[model samples]
Target chain A: MLNIIWPVFIIISFMYAIVTGRVNEVNNGIFEAVSDAVELSITFLGTICLWNGIMEIVKKTTLIQKLTKLLNPLVKVLFPDLKHSQKAKEEISMNMVANLLGLGNAATPLGLKAMKTMQEENCKKDTLSNAMAMFIVLNTASLQLIPTNVIAIRTSLNSANPTQIILPVWGATIIAAVVGVLATKLITKKIK
Target chain B: MVNYISAAAIPFIILGIIIYGLIEKNKVYDSFLEGAKEGIEIVFKMFPTLVGIFLAVGALRSSGVIELIVKIVEPMTKMLSIPSEIMPLALLRPISGSASMAVAVDIMKNYGVDTFVGLITSTIMGSTETTFYTIAIYTSAVGIKKTRGILVAALLADFAGMIASVIIWRIMSTSFC
Candidate 1:
């Protein structure tokens, strides 16, 4: 189904451009795109550097362990086949925690590490294990409660109530998380 | 007992991310640089494609091509009974995140950010990512030559999120009272 549609869509969008004579308009767009990415990448790199230090302090204090233990039961439900391991619980907990706080910057490394850990535990290379894929879907869905980016945009735009976005963000995240989990679970169960 | 356990780990969880990145600082820098470099490369790669598409769309928008399309789409609007207010999102959401953000922001400012409209806008923003940007970046980074089903899956999920946001916003705004 997708194999056919996506290529066609791309071709159509491209053809639309060529037909409209906008193909020549790309030099500026290219420069703009590269500049935007470079700027964003630098900021993200710095963010990870700073956030890593904070994560270390938390680890030394056993904060991560505690959170891992707390989320284990729900993790069990979400990844039913996952063995109850101290490590697995920690990775999933860490990923979910980073996401909840709206720190995708933090969540990603955790998500990647969790996948590696899951892959090692499950012993699969050709396909994603149930747990890893579930986590991926959830992380990508991004259960943001405070929505820092949106708030920042609002503030910069001179919004009267930047903080007012919190509840709506929460609603979106919670629903997306639930739907994402459910859909992933159904698909995983059916396929594998 | 459970809340107690996780709450305590908040500080440490953050710490781990920091230390992980730092301990592998070299790897992190290399990857970051690679992404930066690749980003530039991608700009060049996607430029020819993006500009052509953008100009066509821009002209469609500026030259009233879209307005005609909108008229064509008006019957569906009536059929679904969608508000005239959200018609722009139907057009704007797929192609340009910033444009939709502008539209959403305008709504928020005029109607009050605390209102239902504001909530819907924020919900939509939070729920769906910049789909094309994410897809292109992630797929290119992974070196997936053909991203087969992923694109459709992602956009479908985004569309679903948009619908859900509207419905949920409507419910929250009304049901609470």
Candidate 2:
């Protein structure tokens, strides 16, 4: 999907720039984007490292096990294929934990690990399983309890009530998540 | 208020994790270093993908494609009660995080940060994930070539988030007013 989408973006943008006579602007944007990507990755590096480190500690202490146990009922319902797979369950729960805390960068590795684990259990190599589809929906909808980054940005911009959007964000994300999961379940059921 | 509590949450989580690690008598420091090293490697692996998407998004925005998109979508957005000014952010939210952040920042700058449009943009930004980026990095990490059904589901979620943000903000703003 991305294979087609990524190139199409570049092609469309280039064509649009030429037609609009904004080639110079596109050139500058490309240069700035390169630097921006590097800077953005570096920023992610710091936060990812810190959160992963904390997660590592949590894992070593078996806190993840406890979390998995606590989340098992919900997780099992969402990912029935992972019902007996303790490792996948642990990784998925940890990923959900990171996501709920709004640690996206930290959640990615855990999510990737969970996906890889689930893939290993699947009979088919390339095709996604129903559980994997559900996981993707849940992760992407990502019902965040604390939108730390958004609030931080609003605060930096000097909003009088930076966190005023918190309740609305939570409400919207929950709705998105519920809708996503329902859609995934219905679609996967029909396909099966 | 909620802001103060949320702000303190991260530190509280860190402290709790550390305390639990100590109680469990784990080699917390060594484990942390190992995880941090792994995190760095993951960041490096994601760098090229980030560069490709960022440049495309940057060009798309700078070349006025996004603005053109906004113009085209203006009527639909108005009918949906979403401000036309935030159309670009809604469109970009599912594609790239930084790009959408830039749009949200721009909206907050042009409109007062506390205004209805600004609040909706912020809420939308917070609620939605970058679906394309997440799918790309995650599927590649797992070496999955065929991403069946996830894309549509994720995009649906993004759409839901966008509409919900606008609706939720409208209700909340009305109550406040």
Clash totals in order: 15, 0
Off by over 4 Å in 1: A1-68, B1-60, B77-119, B130-157, B172-177
DockQ of 2: 0.50
The TM-scores, one per candidate, come to 0.58, 0.71
Candidate 2 lDDT for residue B114: 88
Q: Looking only at chain A, give the TM-score of model 2 against the true structure.
A: 0.68
> How do the candidates score on chain B by TM-score?
0.53, 0.64
Predicted candidate 2, C-alpha RMSD: 5.2
Model 2: lDDT of residue B126: 82
Clashes of 2: 0
Show the lowest summed lDDT stretch of 10 residues, model 2 chain A. Answer: A59-68
C-alpha DockQ for predicted model 1: 0.14
Model 1 TM-score, 2 decimals: 0.58
What is the docking quality class of candidate 1?
Answer: incorrect
Q: Tell me which residue pairs clash in candidate 2.
A: none
Candidate lDDT scores, in order, read: 0.54, 0.78
